[model samples]
Each structure stands twice: as structure tokens, then as C-alpha cells.
Target: MTRDGAGLRVGDRPYRVFGCNTYYLMAWAADPNLRRHVDEVLDTAVQFGLNTVRTWAFNDGEDQWNALQPRPGEHDERVLEALDYVVWQAGRRGLRLILALVNHWDDYGGRRRYAAWSSTAKRADDFYRDAACRRCYRHHARTLVERTNSYTGRVYRDDPTILAWELGNEPRCARDPSGLTLQYWLEEMSAHLKELDPNHLVGTGLEGFWGKWREGRYNPPRWLGGQGSDFLWNHQPDTIDLMSFHVYPDHWHMDEKATMRWIREHLDAAAELGKPAVMGEFGKRGPRALRERCFRKWLDATTSAATDTEHPAAAGALFWALYHDDYPDYDRFGVYRRHESTVDLLRSYTAR
Candidate 1:
């Protein structure tokens, strides 16, 4: 894997990361009966001309239903084997993956479990500053990075199928509105991941929300999650190879123009940092025409971003999810089954 300007290159070929989110692959890929569905998703992704994907690498302390690792340093061999199969399958299909190491939310016993394990009170921000918490996290991360893929008999660090490693799913520190703690956490974790595997890129899975903190204690009251997350300043870490931001205009009640401007501003920031950027996760629930219009505008701007300027062009855009209708409790986020128009739009730009 080589960095080519604002994008990536695999063996001298420019790689455009037009893709979608499939966070459940690790769990499903681990099951033999459900493993075929993993294949189906990748097949459809390739069919739609999507070359990259974003999925979860860590599912900590969850029940039997979906748990990659029931407890820290104790991985479910079945799930681990399934994840190995998923990696092999993606490599076979010639698709890339961006695996998130943790979740900021409580989906899979995230920070809450970590705090409990460390015998500390549940504070979302404590995961960043707590020494014991960081140690446990590092142990888990080290195990994953150094583990040899069962399918290929190759360590994950040497696997080219992995495009990058995201720190968390939309990480935030609501308590640290000043942005110092979150920034420090990004620096520490990113550096840790880089040390473990320098071949793959690392990113802070942040929802692009800019605020004033480093220069002075100035956080906008209207920030996205009542958390202190600065899109511009956070991506300034030396360990961060690219900038990742999620867009949810419809959910945020943002208009097309506003969403378009959000894309441009984040791209500009990436250009300033001399790093590539990707729309890691974005989508909405609404009529087909509206989704089409919004996606078309975003895709056009993303594909047309100028690469010659100091700021590099946008690297890629991955939609919220791609799930099939038959899947259990599927949230109806599948691109192939839900909206044909959006699929067409993705095909058109990804082929470029």
C-alpha cells in the first residue's frame, strides 16, 4: 500500500474508495451458515463498482448473539475465524476494508465495559485519560494487529486487503468540550496502532464537527453531539494518515447546499494537512428522489475535487450501510435492495 497524493495506490494502480458501511461482517462472517451472506455483500459491492468498505474490528464484551471478543484479551475463536474468512473473501474479490477498532457508543459494551473493567465510574471521556483503560485497549489492539490470519497464514500487518484502521466509530468526548482530551487520545491511540502496523493507514472515526479549543477554549454550543470534536485540529496528528468524517444532513436537518459545503470544508482541511479524506459513513431515510439528488450532488463534488491545489481531492465516499433484506433484524440500509437510483449514482462515479 502506497500513498498517492490524496488517494491510495495498490501496486502502482490508483485506488478510488467508493464504498459503503457493513459493520456486521465480522460477526456474520464468523458464522458458517451466515458466512455466505458476507460473500453476497462483497459480490454486490464489487458489482456496484465499490472498491472499499468500512466494518467493525472490535465487538467487546457482548452477549452470545454478537461478540467477537467476549472480554478483553479473550477472543472467541469462532468469531476470529469468521473474521479471517471475511478478510480472505475480500482479498479474493479484490475489495479493500477500513476496520474500526472500537465503538464510541454502547453498542458492544464499549467505553462502559472498559470503565467497569478498570473499576472506575462510567465516564465516556475517562477512556481517553484513564491509564488502565488505555492499557487494556492497547493489549486488545496489539493482539489483533499481530495475529496471523488463519485463512492466509499471514499476519494482519502484512495484509494489503486492509485499507486502514479507524480508532472508533464517531469518537467523541462530551465532557472535554475543550477538545484537549480527545486530541490527546487520538494522538496516543493512533501512534499505538501505527507502531503495531505501519503499513496500514490510521484515522479517528470522527463526525466532522469543527470547534475552537486549541487556540482558545471556544466550543460552539451547537456542536453535533454535545461533545468536543474538532475536525480540523484532530486530524493534525502525525500518526493520522487521512481525515475521516461522516455526513448525515437529513438527520441533522441540513440542506443540500449545507451538506455540499460541509464536504468542501473538510476536503479543504485535509488538503491543508496534506492528507487524504474519506466520507466514512453517510445516509438518510426518505424518498428516493431526495436521496438521489443529495447523493448526486455529494458524489459530483467528491469526484470533481481538484487534485492540483495544495489540498488534495476527496479520496472516497462510503454510504451508511449495505445490508440485504433477508438478514436478521436488518435496518433496511442496503443499497442494492433499497434504492436503485443511488446504486446507479455510485456505479457512475466509482467507475471514474
Candidate 2:
């Protein structure tokens, strides 16, 4: 995939990212009994006309489930093979993937784990500036990019199935309200990833916060000056090929109108920057009717933007998540195959 003007294209043909997030694919694929869940979700994606999927590619620390990197610079071959399986299977189904390299939170031993492994720093935010932590991150990234998929026999860097590599999941540095720390880190890491694999795109997995430098009245009160990221500044790095932001109106205390504004703000920014933007994650929790209403509104806003011939609109939007019957709806945001109404809504949107 490549960017042309404000939109994305594949070998001269236009491409839009209508997709869903399946963050647990790697873990489930590692378990023989649970691997079917991965297949089930992807099959559903195809059935719905969805073409892209976002998932976590990192699992650090020894205690984490299916920890891909149980130790710094070391990995469990079995788990890595499982990841390879995910890449192979997704490609087989003609689906593109956006793989996040790390997490900002500690759920899968993210920044906090890296900080612990490399220094005495107790705050997860310290991972951004620590030299040792940066080294470990680069190492892990190199391993993944250079990895030769056991199933496909193709190095990850050379694989066309990968749409992009996300820097981290919603990266932030609350300790530095100016957002310079996180900004610099993103610039450095994105440049490094590009040096390693110039064939693929790199993105900052940010939540679309406005930093002190770029704050405006359009921003939500909670993000008046950002949690520690400048959406525009963070994407200034030349190596950063794609712009990404996530939305959770319920969690952010935003109503439907505010949510649409937030998305439009990012799409406008992406157009100014000459890059394609994606609503990497978005969802609401409540009764089915309420969820459907919000989803329809949000999808309408994004899809409408895609039709703008004068300016580049959002490349596409992906819902909060996709899950199968085998898994519990742990987050309430999970959209299962049995939810025919919701499935139909997403399917219709993708078809558009």
C-alpha cells in the first residue's frame, strides 16, 4: 500500500481501510484449541467486506500470557511461530494488517515492563527517555521485522500483507505535559523502524491528543493540552507514513456530536499533512440500540469524508473490536458474529 496525495492506493488503484480490531489474535493463535477463534473472526471480516485488521504483536515479560518476548532480546519460538501463522492466514484471506509493536499500558508488559527491565524507574513514562529501554525496544522491533515467517518463508519486512507498524498503543507521557518527550521519542523510534524496514509504513498509535503547542477550542476538555502528545507534531517525522487515532466517546465523556467533530479534526489534519488517517479504534458501550446509533453516526461521518473529492478524508475507520463466541465479551465493546444486527450494520458500511 502507498499514499498518493491525501488518500491511499495499491499499485495505482485506490484503497480504503474498512476494518476491525482483533487485538487477541496472536495469543489465541498460539493455543491449538483456541486458534479457531482467530480464523472465525477473520472469516467474519471477509463476510462483512472488511479489508483490514489491527492487532497487538508484542507480549513482553515472563508472566504475560503467550509472552512473545519473555526476556529482553529473547523470544519464545512457539509464540513467534503463532504470530507468523496470523500473518500468513490473514494474507491468505486477502486481508491487510496493522500490527502494533508495543503497548503504552502494562496489560501485556508494555512500557512499564521495559522500564523495569532496563532501569530503576518506576513510572511507565520513564520508558520514553531511558537509553536502556530504547535499546530493548529497538531490539524487539528488529527481531520482528527481520523475522522470516515460518509459514510463508518471507521476511516480515518484505511481506506485503502488513499495512503498517504502529509505534505503540495510545502512547502518552503524562509526566511531561508539554508533550515534547513523547514527541521526540516517536520521531526517533519511527525513524529507526524505517531504517530497518523502509518497505513498510510506520505510525504513532496515538489517541489524537493536542499538545500545548497545538491546543484549540475543538479539543475535548480532558485533552485541552493533551495527555502528553501533539497529534500533528508527532506525525511530522518523515518516516511516519500513516496517521492514527482512536475514539471511545463513552469513556471520554463525549456525545455523538463531539465525537464526530473529533474525527473530522483529525481528518483535516491528515489532509494538511498529506497523509492518510485512520480511526484505528472506536466504540461505545450500552444497550444494543444505543451502540448501533453511535456506530452508525460515526461510520457515516467517516464514510462521508472518504467521498470528499476536494480534500483527503479519513482512509477508513475500524470499530473497537471483533470477537468470536469462544471468547467472553470482557469489554462490552466486543462485536460478535451472533449480533446479526450489528454485523449487518458494519457489513453495509464496508460495502459503501
Candidate 3:
């Protein structure tokens, strides 16, 4: 059940996914009563016509100064519980989930010092050192899907509540890595996930680097997208189901039109893969007009991608976040203002 040409077939055609990243879903899973909170967040998403929710399952919230490793299912108890409830409650709220498996972006929103993080020239040494870490991630992902599928009380598997499975939020780092190494990880991780829960769609998390590489412009720079991961991103689309990516108008808050143009180009570039080109991440700051413009540009970009341009393979778009907690107003990129309004617009781009 997939749609679009990017290797992602759909249960239904013309399915334009919409949702937000549960950036801190696991970090604050300390409350004894998390059901309501999860419902509230997802509730807002459903209320505004959202179709999905993306959350990170790795990073466990510990300071990742040294080699990143969790306490072997340390937060699994709470994290899975929250997810189970998210599926249950989200259904009640009328929403789905496009869950991310791992992430390198930290609180500072710059560099991540996680299990696979590395300096500009350094490699993901920790990933190489502790085989257990990788194994844990693979196993955990399998369990996540299995549990979701096993849900009996309004089961989530066959329902529309569960979206595609994302493998690694930006598998490539800010360093030039051996293409073989990165590909090996992506192929293996993606395979492992599908083997366990063959029901959901799966794909790697990219920074739109595939399109950027083809266009000769980039965000995290050339060194970040792996030595040559673009080949696999386009040529080997079958390794996963869809082509997912992230993007943000560099250092500009008024590039709504520009953002649309870039996404259109990305879709064109994805022509060969014949897959749905999805913007996994994007953001902006400045006047509300600027943000709304950029958002609208991308919204229009998804519903109608260009052909033979920089990108013609695009399929959908997912905003960076909908911060559900009280945080500083440093970057006004969030769609909401410490309230649920931000989350609302984040998922309101329906084609109705």
C-alpha cells in the first residue's frame, strides 16, 4: 500500500502525509500520567487535519559527551508506553505517526554528540567501537513496530494511525564518510526494520542532500551527505520505501518563494527514483508573514511538484517541530507559541 514514484507505495493514492517531530517525546517521559499529555499534543495535530507525528526513539536523553550508549532499554519502558498511548490516543484524535528511529540534532540545534556523532573530519567511531549500540538500535526498532502491530485495543498496525518508518534522522554527519560505510549501515538498518514489521513503509532520513548534491548547493556542506550516498539515495531506492529529506532556507527568514523553488527543484531531481520526495525538516524566522509564506510555499510545493526541474520527485513535507513544552523564544520557527496553535498549523496543509 504505497503511492508516488520514490519507491514508497501507498495504502491509498494521492496520500499527502502531514505531521510534526516529537523532538522531546522521550526526554520528558517522567510523568506518572502521560496519557493525557500525549493525547493533548496529538489531539491538537488531529484537530488541525494533520495525518502524522514523527518522534525519535534513540538518544535516550543522556549527555552524549563520550561514546553515546543507552542503559540497554533504559528508557524503553516509558518510551514505548508513551508510543503505545500515542497510537491509542492519536486514533482517538484522528492522527497517524511517522516515527524517526534516530537523530543527531541536539538541544542546541547544531551538532549532535550521540552514538554516531563525529567532528568535521572524525568518523562515527562510537558506532564502530560498540557493536552492541547498533544492535540495540536495530532490535529496539523491531520491537517498536512489533508492539504497534500487536495492539489489540483498536490495533494500530492495519489502521491509518501508523505512518512510514524513518531510519536515522540524518544518517550522514558533518564529515566526509566512506560511502561504503554509510551505505552498509543504511541498507542493513532499513532491512532489519522491514523484516520485523513488514506492514509500514520505511526509508532513510536525509538532509535533501541528494537534490542539493545534484544542484551544486547544500546546507551542511558536501562532507556531510556521506562520501557518495547520493548514488544509493537515487539508484537504490528499493533499500527502503521512500526518499525522505530535510531542508531549511539558509540564514534567511523571507525565502518562502525561494524555499518553494528549491523543493520544486528537488522533486525534479528525484525523477529517476520515481519516488515521493518528502521534506523531512524545514524552518524559518522573522515576521509571521515570512513564516507563513515559507510554509505556504512548501505546502503548494508538495501538492504540485515540478517536473524536469532541480526536483520533480518530491512527495510531501514535515516541519521541524511543534514544541509541546515551555521553552525560550530564541528561534521563533515553531508553528505554535508555547501553546497548541503552533502544532495546529504544522499539520494544517491538507489538500482539501
Candidate 4:
């Protein structure tokens, strides 16, 4: 279940991931009729030869729809059942998942909600250090991992359908630009997750930022937003099994050329640390052709490097998203099924 020199392995066979993100999977699965939508998405993933997926497993607070934890330590059985269906469905279809536990952003009222529930008006950074917030998160994590799946009649801790459990979605402590705070928080939470589910892998859902204190060979300029996290140092903990990073050149306003370099840094860090690494998220805007080219470059690099490099630790890349046709509310980053050329490109990589 751990990484060998080449990368992650199932026994002696190397398990290279051709994956994509479906952040709204659980949301879509909430309704029995809409559950088919989840299947369709997974269907496309399988058809494209993608063996893995990354999804949001946690939606906190009362206001968010399909909220997993409507209140601290309490869960909505209906929503949980929907997610149980997702896990079982993905497993039946032969797709493993990387389930993120929390979000840094407010899309699902993430860490901020935790702070609020703890009776504080503090920001996301405060959630890590706050005693009440940490306790709430600990309870939430425990409650989630221990819950037996109603649909599969199996405890989540025993499910192989889950590839890994992520600490959070792009966790960052902007207030503590030094990275020490985030590092401490990761140490505690990562260890806690391992104790809760030793059978599954754990990864910090970091965006591969190398904080000031622990920069290795490359130190990206601060303007590029490489502060508040030391990706390499962060993953060095005994509890973390995988190193994860995200790439969004268009959103970050970085040149397309920087994407490959960012990937190289993380891969190098993973290789050096003797752990597997994944580009868990990446996307771009503008014309479809440009996006296709960027994605193709990453796929090519990952696949080609597996054989060519002495230290092959790049597990694979997962594009930002894959939305079905007629899903409505399309975004620039989502690769809808109608985007035939891009879909073809993603499918081609899986064929590799």
C-alpha cells in the first residue's frame, strides 16, 4: 500500500493513476435519481481508462447543500448514504478514490465553519491552532472514518476503493506565512488520520508550495505564492504517504511554461523523499486547444518519465474537472464531455 522506488504499487505491480477530479460527486449523489449522474461521470472515467478519482468527501456547516456534517459531530444520514453509494459504485466500476476531508475555501464552509462552530469569528488560519476547532475537526474525522457504509455494509476504514485520505483541499495558513503553523497542524492531523484508518494512505492536500524555511533546490519567488508551505518538508512526516500538488497557470497568471517546472519540483521532492507524488489538480483557461496542449504536456511528461528517469515518483496527473454534457453552469476550467478534442487527449493518455 506504500510507495516503492518507482512509485505506488499494488504488490509488485506499479499503479500509475490516470485520474480526474469530480468535486461535486457527493453533491450529485444526494438524490436517488441524480445518483445516475455520478455513475455517468464514473462511466466516462472508466471508458477513458482512468483508474483513479479525486473527490470531496466533506461538506461542513448548515448552509451548504448536502452538508455531510450539518453540525459538529452530527451527520445527515441521507447525504452519507449518497456518499456510501458513491464509494460502492466507484469500487464496483474499478475506480479508486482520493477523498479530501476538508476544504480551505468556503465552497463547503470548510475550516471557517469549524472555527465558527467552535464559537469564534477567526479565519481559516486560526482553525489549526484553536483548541476547540481542532477538537471538532478531530471528532469529525473520527466520526467519518469509523462510520460503516450502509450500502456496502463495510466500514470505510476497510474499503480499498479509497486510494487515500487527504488532510484538506489545498490547506494553507496565509497568516503564518512562515509555514511552521501549517506544518504543526499537518503533523497533528495527519497522525490522527493514520490512527483512525491505518489501512488507507494519507496525503496532505497541499499545492506544492516550498515555504521559506525549508526550500530545497528551487525557491520560487514569493510573488508566485510559494509561501506558507514547505511541500517537501511537509511530506517528510512518517504519517504522510503521498505528496500532492495543484497547478492552475491560468488562474495564477503564471506562464504555461511554469507548469512543467512546478511539476518537476514536486516530483523531485517526492523522489528524493522516497514517496509517490501526484499532480492531484491542474487546469487552464482560454481556447480548448491551449488547454489540450497543456494537459498533453503533463501526461507526456508523467508517462515518459516513468521509464526514462532513474527516480520515477510522479504517480500521474488529474485534470481540474470533468463535467458531463448539459450539466449546466459550465466553467472555463471544467472539461465537459462535449469538449471532444480535450476528451480525446485525456483518453489517449489513459491508453498509454
Q: Cα lDDT for residue 217, model 2?
A: 34
For residue 256, model 3's alpha carbon misses the true position, in angstroms, by 5.9
Q: What ranges in model 2 sit over 4 Å off? A: 223-226
Candidate 2 shows a clash count of 0
Clash list (residue pairs), candidate 1: 30-82, 271-311
Whole-model alpha-carbon lDDT for candidate 3:
0.57
Better of 1 and 3 by lDDT: 1
Ranking by lDDT: 2, 4, 1, 3
Task: Point out the higher-scoring one by TM-score: 1 or 4.
Answer: 4
CA shift at 175, candidate 4, in angstroms? Answer: 1.0
Candidate 2: worst-modelled 10 consecutive residues by lDDT:
215-224
In candidate 1, stretches whose alpha carbon ends up further than 4 angstroms from where it belongs are 62-64, 213-221, 306-311, 328-333
Q: Candidate 1 residues 163-210, lDDT tens each? A: 998988888888888888898999999999999999998978888787
lDDT winner between candidates 1 and 4 = 4
Taking the candidates one at a time, how many backbone clashes does each contain? 2, 0, 25, 1
* Stretches of model 3 off by over 4 angstroms after superposition: 4-13, 26-30, 33-35, 61-70, 73-75, 106-130, 148-160, 211-235, 251-261, 306-312, 325-331, 337-348
User: What TM-score, to 2 decimals, does candidate 4 have?
Assistant: 0.95
By summed lDDT, the worst window of 10 consecutive residues in model 3 runs over 108-117
Quote each prediction's TM-score.
0.93, 0.97, 0.77, 0.95
